[model samples]
Target: MITLWLFILIGAVIAFFWFGRQIAEAAQQHAVGQAEKLNVQLLSVACVKRRLAVLSNGRLGIKSQFAFEFSSDQQSAYTGTMHLENLRLKKMDIPPHRMG
Candidate 1:
């Protein structure tokens, strides 16, 4: 019975480590995914001369500054500046020429 208890304790420790590692890996993957999503969304907005700056405003937010250049002699629409957080929680529309 003593040996069995020891075995169970060791098993619990192993399980804890395994679970912790999985959680850590998941968090890392989530951050990477968010960054990629933000990049895609930024590109989709017809953004030219785009710049991204990260700021810690209690939450991680991306500050974007860009202009939409026009080729048809039309006035270019400049977004001027924008901030985005919780990228996965939002749907974004980006112009096709900028996305590719």
Candidate 2:
């Protein structure tokens, strides 16, 4: 029973790590796409929030929020936020920024 419990814990950890990577990749892609669409330069992206949340389908799912920095001109930077659910982009917030 102890060994079985250990296996289960390890499996859970593995799943969390695997899904985290996928979420990060999806977040980066979304950030990049948004930046390109806005004709800005993407600087950096980082995971901001992660939790189990109710999705649009009314089911519990892994939700991740990413914060990204972008620059329209080389001298100034702006912040953007993106939310992803189960490796899919759910929403994004980009503030008004100056254009080069």
Candidate 3:
């Protein structure tokens, strides 16, 4: 029925946003952890880029990148980035900064 298809379409839209939110949350957590591991204080985290791509294992998944700000001495802020394939961390690029 048309009503059934309409419901399905709405459900798919909701699911897509929900999935994106899940990935963003995972990226934030991972970014925070990485900053802590480097002994820096995480100031902010935000999702910067996202797209569907084939991962290293050839599995199609959402590729996400998060940009974050951190401070080594709470005085100077530095920028960093984290990349994820779905929920798996692919790479992290941290700018050189003095270690506190």
Candidate 4:
């Protein structure tokens, strides 16, 4: 009886490890699929922004302000100010930036 109990204990440990590995692999595959979809959608959007900066509002997980320069044609320049809602961008202000 003691030997049988020992064998069952070892089996339980092996099963736990196998189940954990399978769950982690499934989560990683889901993340990869979502990233691929985002890449395709971003390619369709023609706007390009650069020289970005993020400002925090002194609260946890809250971005108070953001500033960047973007040009749709990649030739002209403009500065943008974005407002955040629930950690996502809600509004954007992009006026023309004077070039030298």
lDDT of 4 by residue, 1-100 (tens): 9999999999977965665444344433433343353332111112232222343544433223344444444465455455543234546554644433
Q: Candidate 1 — which residues are off by over 4 angstroms?
A: 40-100
lDDT of 2 by residue, 1-100 (tens): 9999999999998998898998898888888889889999999999998997899889988988899999999999999899888888988988999989
What tens-digit string does per-residue lDDT give for candidate 3 at 1-100?
9999999999988987899999988988998788879989999989889888899999888898889999999899999999999888989999999988
Ranking by lDDT: 2, 3, 4, 1
lDDT of the structure predicted as candidate 2: 0.91
State each model's CA lDDT, in order.
Answer: 0.37, 0.91, 0.90, 0.43
Q: Supply the TM-score for candidate 3.
A: 0.88
Model 1 RMSD in angstroms: 13.9
Clashes of 3: 0
Tens digits of per-residue lDDT, candidate 1, 23-81, equal 34443344345436544321122222222344555553333332322221223221222
Worst 10 residues of 1 by lDDT: 42-51
What order do candidates take by TM-score, descending? 2, 3, 4, 1
Off by over 4 Å in 2: none
Q: What's the C-alpha lDDT at position 70 in model 4?
A: 41
